[model samples]
Target: MKKSGLISVVAFIVSVIVTASSLFTASGDPFPGPVMIAICIILPIIGLLAALISNKGALKFIGFTGNLLILLLSVVVPAVSTLFWNQP
Candidate 1:
């Protein structure tokens, strides 16, 4: 469980970085950005899976919440930025 929880934390952090970078690159083109966003989705799911495999209560809760936030940020941040992109 400890090992799995550690993996989850690492994946979650990487996911966040990927999501932020995706947003940072949103202005020019959407090619690599989209790919990174896909990664953003993938990493958290990986984390969640690791956590589930651990089968510990606290890690499970943390994993679920972190996974949800990572997924939410990946999608919501891009959408919100796009919506306000032209506002200046």
Candidate 2:
């Protein structure tokens, strides 16, 4: 696999694990909705900035991985939140 592909896969897997575990933990509201949203939004931007700043392949991998993880978290967290919130 290319570096980018490897990074993306690792990021996806990590994000899935983190997101799943987070869903089970509760503190009053259970979901830290806005915080998750901000992370999702900010990570990609930071990744892009890293990509722009670095000339090394490893840095590129890191940025891509970060972006991928953020994207996965963005989708999974909201979906999970909706499912739990809407349950009857």
**Number of backbone-clashing residue pairs for each candidate, in the order shown:** 0, 0
Off by over 4 Å in 2: 1-31, 72-88
How big is the positional error of residue 27 in model 1, measured in Å on the Cα after superposition?
5.1
Query: Per-residue lDDT of 5-72 in model 2, one digit per residue for the tens?
Result: 44443444454455556656675323487755444455355555545555557656666666666666
lDDT of each: 0.75, 0.55
Candidate 1 displacement at residue 44 in angstroms: 0.9
Top lDDT hit: 1
TM-score of each: 0.61, 0.43
lDDT for model 2 comes to 0.55
Error of 2 at 65 (Å): 3.3
Model 1 lDDT, full chain set: 0.75
Q: Candidate 2: minimum summed lDDT over ten consecutive residues — where?
A: 1-10
Q: Lowest summed lDDT over 10 consecutive residues: which window, candidate 1? A: 28-37
